[model samples]
Structure formats: C-alpha cells, structure tokens
Target: MAKVSNILFVHGAWANSSAWEKVLPLIGAAGLTGTAVSLSLTSLADDVATVKRAIALIDGPLLLVGHSYGGSVITEAGSDPKVAGLVYVAAFAPDVGESAGSLGAGGPPTRLLEVVRPDEHHFFKLTREGVDEVFAQDLTATERAMIFATQNPLAGAALGGEVTAPAWKEKPSWYLLASEDHTIHPELQKKMAARIGATTVTVEASHVAMLSQPDAVAKLIVQAAA
Candidate 1:
C-alpha cells in the first residue's frame, strides 16, 4: 500500500469548507492529503464529531489545521491518535480549561463583532457591511459579498464550551499569526502561541491569512508536514 500523508483543514465560524478553496490544492501538491471540514458552528460537540468523521477517513499520517473557531475544533480533534501535527492559522488556540467565548471576552471588542445580532434562533452573524470591511477586506469586493451572502451563522453558545483536550500540548504545533488581524488582537495571538510553545510565523495581513496569504500559509503547512 502507498503511504499517505493526510491534512485536514477545519474552517472557522461565519465560514465553511469554501474558506479553503485555494488552500486544499497547495496541500495536495505538498504531498499530503487535504480535507477541509465544514464544522457546525452551532454546537461544539457537533463540530468535534464532524472533525472525527473526517479523521476516520484518513488511513495514514495526518496534519490537522484549523482557523478561528476551527482552532478549538482541531485542538480537540487532533487528539486523535493518527494526527501527527497541527497548524493554527490566525485561529483560537485555547487551553483545556479555556473556551473561545471566555478568551475573546478578555480582549478589546473587535469592530467586526459589533454588528453581530442574535436572532430568535440565538445564532450570531456579521452584518453585510461588517463582513465587507472587517471580515473580508483582503478579498475582492465580489468575493467578500459572495461570502457575506452565504456565511454561516454561529451559535453564541459554542464559544462558551471549553475544550476537553488541547492538542498543542501533546503534538508539535505551528501558528500563523496575522499582524493586521482586525478580529483577534495580534497581541493575544502572540500570547496564545507562546503558551503552546508553537513555531510562529507572522504575516502582514488580516485575520484570514490562509485566504489572503495562501502561499505563506501553504508553505507553513508544507514545512510542518515535511
């Protein structure tokens, strides 16, 4: 049987598998399997299960990558015995006792979050204008609008749940820090990366570094897998 080096990409809230449209191919070219997971941002448990479902399909060494809230998901999911490494792209790198909701609360509120309004369903979504200016500013106007129109609404409750296991503590870890990130403070990302003792790569870009700086992001993943 051929050896397979699989990589799983987990996307953050307000986004889906589409977030990795440009990233997946780069991962494949690097000689690793790439799987972008569309998480249920509504529930932490569901998202973990979704990650597990994706992991079950892998038959070889794996690198699990997650962005934003997806970081929390991969932290838990990467605990799977098969996962060989982890890459966090401007994503939450929460500890075992911490949750995304709690960590985000300590920081100065992000402008992108100011427009989020809860619906009767208790899900939160960024306003159209906020998505354009705050969330996807690096992307073209057309791309931003398309993402804004189809963005996933995440449940506020999901961020409040703590991770049962933090994969970075056990696995070799890499973090891509977005210097110009408007969503999570770069300072906070630095602190998180420090806590995990991760090999950090700083990009002069926004929160969506994987999208805006795909080449750099891909290089990091390739380096980790290599």
Candidate 2:
C-alpha cells in the first residue's frame, strides 16, 4: 500500500503559523504531518523562500495547502518535485500573469480596507476592529479580541507582485470555498476556483474555516494526501 503524504499549510496575511494549530493535529491523526508555514508576506521572494524551506524538510511526497494570501505563496512553492497536489482553502489561486491584488479587484468586501495602515517599511496591518470584523468574525468575542491583539502585519508589496507560475495549472488542485467568508467575497472564491480547474467543495464557515470547521478541512486534506 502507498504511504500517506505530508501536508504543509501556508497561512495568509495578518496571521502567523499558529493559525493552523487547531487543524494540524487533525491532519496528523490521519498519519500526515501538517506543517504550517509563516510567510514574511513582505515580498514574493521572501514568502517563496519560506515555503521552499518547508518543502526541503519533507522527505516524502507532499500535499501543499494555502489559505487566503498564502495561496499566492503555494502557487509558486508547489512546483517542487515533492509536492504532489495543491489545496486552496478560500485562498488565492491566481492563474499565469495574475497578481494577488488583481484577485481582489472584483471589489473589496467592505470598508475594512480603510482601516489598514502601513509602516515606513510598507507592511500593512489591520486595526483591531479590522481583525474582529474581517478576519475572526466566526470566533467568540474573547477569541476575536485576542486574535486582533496578536495579528501580524503583512508587507504591502506581497499583494502587488505577480505569481510567476501558478502551480494549479500544472498540478491537481482542490479548493475550499468559504461560503460565509467576509474577508474575500464568496463570489471571488468561486471565480478563482473555476479558473484553476480545481475540484471544489463549499462550507458555510468563515474565512478561517480551518479553525471554525476543522473536521471538514481535514477531511479534504486527508483525501488529497491519500
């Protein structure tokens, strides 16, 4: 029988590697080590290098999963020979010649864009309210507040850069559509999924569905690894 493959998770903007904490153990239970990647989110080069470091650690075949902006990272990182498949969880799966910023051009979900502030380094971080309303909308009041306090600011340059090669165009792709996601509109998710020819599934959860609906997310990852 074939052995199970490793599952590497790349988290999106305003988040650290810990974003996949709840879902990691579930993936492990299925006999796959779920490695969570924290991108610099400052530059495409930095983020891709971070993902390559994760790829190098895996000795067997792998299933690379990306959520939100992390999708942009995996789109390039998944090109490694060890990467066997790709899973995008309401993540950006831009096609060739597409920039991450272009994906959101359909329209901003709400007025949250106004709350973003950039430092001298051009890294963008959301305000506390931005985190509560846009990101952790599915969490409890306490959970949401804590997340806001710990959120990381991503570099604005990450969004403007284009993905050189979209792994989805070369590899088998799977997409999880967060039906209730407020961060990236559900309509855009469908558009991205269809463009990449991904096998698609929908969940009525928020942006962080891996946290809010772990079992459902794990099932899909486990299936891809299997």
By lDDT, who's the top model here? 1
Each model's lDDT:
0.85, 0.84
Runs of candidate 2 with Cα error greater than 4 angstroms are 1-3, 107-109
- The residue-by-residue lDDT of candidate 1 on 1-226, one tens digit each, is 1233788899998999989988888887877778888877988888999999989988877888999889889888888888888899998888878888877777666786686778998999888877766776788888888888988999988877789899888998999999888888888889888899989999987788888899999989888887
Model 1 TM-score (2 dp): 0.95
Q: How many pairs of residues collide in each model?
A: 2, 0
What would the TM-scores of all predictions be?
Answer: 0.95, 0.94
Instruction: Show where candidate 1 strays beyond 4 Å.
Output: 1-4
lDDT of 2 by residue, 75-173 (tens): 988899888889999888877767677888755564557667889988888887776777767888887777778787888788877888878877898
Candidate 2 lDDT score at position 66:
91
Output the lDDT of residue 106, model 1.
76
